[model samples]
Target: MKNYWTISRKFEQNMNRLQKPKKETFKKRLQNYLIKFKTKSPQITEKYKYFLAGFIEGEGSFYVGLKKNSTSKYGLKVDPAFSVTQNKTGVVHLIAFMVLFQTGRIDFKSGSENTYVFKIENRQSLVEKVIPFYKSYVLPLTCSTKKQIFNNWVNVINKLDQGVHKTSEGLAYEILPLVFASRTKGKREKSLQDYQKLVLLGVRQ
Candidate 1:
């Protein structure tokens, strides 16, 4: 069955490869490529899949770290502080967002103050998302450093609900940001590499 939600799932699988391989003999970082790129789930992808190919080909604005993507288009930043969980690849240069897709929360108006903790309703980023390149490839990748950043994300989200104003830009009926995907540089260079490998695999399949 063709799942309506083709976006995030592709991301998860892609992110898996970017994760530190359990066995030291692991090679081919393709899977990790796709998953890491999953963070930037823009509305265009949600409404239309035209960008899917280019996205897989590493043609958009995603990087590693807290810096903003040169290709950062609006609308992705739907919520005041909500970030999509682009977990597998690790830190991009920018830090626009990094939250998992969290839907079905108790109703509340925007601009209110409260701490919200939305559980992983659909997808979420894991360890590989935060592993550094040197650590990922050279040394034994661990989650100790990643956990701190992960904790920061949790803290931000929790704090948002705890009194931070969830304000929007005027009366615009922006769809509430239920999903969080972080934007960053590509896996290989400034784009995700795992995407192409998966596409090839998909073709082979």
Candidate 2:
């Protein structure tokens, strides 16, 4: 009877040990899965570059946003951005974009769950990395509407980079028109005339 009791106790101890959970075991497994498919380094090859460009062609956007700013020389700011959106299932592709571009960030898309966006809004990054990459790999493969929008976006970026948006005349005659033209016709919140009026007011001030 004593021997049987001792053997039963040992069996219980072994069972408890096996039942205990390992710390971060699931997390580590997930990391390993992601690493398996993602580029481990920023020095990706030309094939991956073209793959990313094609991905962008279907899922990417080049946007120019206008916002009213109180302290600006023209009472307006031109916000230009490049972005690609994907659901959580495809987040590994977005991670590859981060690795390849060496700039931009991934964020949860506003107003939705399980959606992610890889965005580059920094002007320097746009000029140095995003713009050049698109011009080389993306532009040649874009559809007509996307191609036109991209060209307009590039013109806007170039103008802002050159300080051409500082004067009211430049804001009205040059920058604002491009901003207006870049959008789909019915999607504009304010008309070009309204923006021109604001520029005129800025000039009067």
Which has the greatest TM-score?
A: 2
What tens-digit string does per-residue lDDT give for candidate 1 at 1-205?
4675686788888898788566521122322322544544233333233223222123221122222222323212222222222222322211221221112122122453332221112112322232221233312332454334334444333443453323322111211111112332234332222322322233222
Query: Candidates' lDDT values, in order?
Result: 0.28, 0.81
lDDT of 2 by residue, 10-87 (tens): 999999999999654434544554575463433467998898898899889888888888778778878999899999
After TM-score superposition, the amount by which residue 39's alpha carbon in candidate 2 deviates from its true location, in angstroms, is 10
Best candidate (score: lDDT): 2
Poorly placed runs, candidate 2 (over 4 Å): 1-43, 203-205
TM-score of candidate 1 relative to the true fold: 0.19
